[model samples]
Target: PNSSKVQAYVLSRKMLDKIVLLASRAQLPLEAIIPEDDVWGDTAGELGNFLLLQRSARGHFRISAFVEHTIAFHRSIRSVTPPLTGVPSSELQMDSLSLELQRSIDYLSAQLRQVQLHQLKVCCDEE
Candidate 1:
């Protein structure tokens, strides 16, 4: 029963754990690091599976896993190229990617707050 919805929920929980870890590293509370109204959605296709996590406001994060149907044949025909012998490049790219991902997470968390605020405003206006 490994349906797409279950997979998405698991992925969302994993992302939440990652956010908590990052928040701990920054000495911030987990609740403070994530917005309360964030939502997770998933779409599965023959080409790939996509996890769309978003807040109601302006931020979202997408993590995709390629479906075997799309890449299996290509990978089968691909040849591995040997790395050139030289001093390996610095870890800057890895670090930069990590930093960028953290920033995106933070931004999305903030958007979650905005989403809550918007909901409150709408409710108040209805009165």
Candidate 2:
């Protein structure tokens, strides 16, 4: 996987550009634009249990999960409906989030089963 491409896709392009511009003005290295969340967090494995959730309009939401101080998954879903006026209704958003959570759990369970099966096969072969 191309990390540069993944970072560009995951982060907002406009925000990255602004960070680059500021770094240039301050005569700082371009690497300054990258976040340092991993440095201290990795030392103590403090980030392993972190689960960040961001809610957006209607059914839109983003969930980031970290495991063993590494981001295991990051997902964002945007609502398909037309833009709403003012804030989106919380009840509706919760419902959407709940549905998505169940779907994610089911998917994860399926993957875990596959991993267990592979491990079992490997163990049997070794014996």
Candidate 3:
């Protein structure tokens, strides 16, 4: 059940070091650095469920899933939403992206058991 399935996140060591270094360079007192995805989830009620997905001509995918109005799963991969080119690499990425998303949905359904997710709300990150 959901009780046994706890939300777990792993931060890359290099990313943390870079964040700390940037804070030091800017002379800013950093008490905590909350992930952008968490902020999106916490403030979702006001915006009616908003997820920021960064898309580019050649870019990676950073996605998250919310359960009970909070992030339950998050992942970043080397491929997602590749441009509409018929290139082999982009095609492979599209295939991988679909597989991963479907697998996640199935896992969530099995874990929650009762709750049904009607829609996955997401928006492109213009930044």
Candidate 4:
């Protein structure tokens, strides 16, 4: 019965085209375009304790969760970290990051409700 069920993934044609073009640019074989979240989740390994944060060139933030090295979920939100203005420190920026982090976590939780995932390890990309 379980073997009879087919697994499907929802993808956008536009994104697939982009992946193809990128592969062409790099002269690499076009195989598949797995989302970054899947990779992050895989790195999480067994124990479900890995998270990743990435900053976009346009000042946005993206987050992903992993459970037992499997993708739990991911989302993109407005920037949490503020731009550096040569100031040594700023409480405002810290507060903003804290609030945004919490909000992102909440969003992730809601998304993961359909599945099971846990842990608290985090990995972030430094720009």
Best by lDDT: 3
- In order of appearance, the predictions have TM-scores of 0.24, 0.48, 0.53, 0.54
Error of 3 at 115 (Å): 2.6
Clashes of each: 0, 0, 0, 0
lDDT score for residue 81 of model 2:
30
Name the regions of candidate 2 deviating beyond 4 angstroms: 1-18, 27-30, 35-47, 55-60, 80-90, 112-127
Per-model C-alpha RMSD? 18.8, 12.6, 4.9, 5.8
Q: What does candidate 3's lDDT look like per residue over 1-127, in tens digits?
A: 2455765568899999999999999999889977665666776574433233444334566666665556656666564555534444556766886787677667767866666566666554432
Tell me the TM-score of model 2: 0.48
Q: Give residue 31's lDDT in candidate 4 (0 to 100).
A: 71
Provide the lowest-lDDT 10-residue window in model 1. 117-126
Off by over 4 Å in 4: 1-15, 45-47, 73-75, 79-81, 84-89, 102-126
lDDT to native, each model: 0.30, 0.46, 0.62, 0.60
Quick one: best TM-score, which candidate? 4
TM-score of 4: 0.54
lDDT of 1 at 28: 82
lDDT of 4 by residue, 1-127 (tens): 1124443578889988888898899999987667655666666545565556555455566666655575555566564553423556577765776676677678766755654444555444343
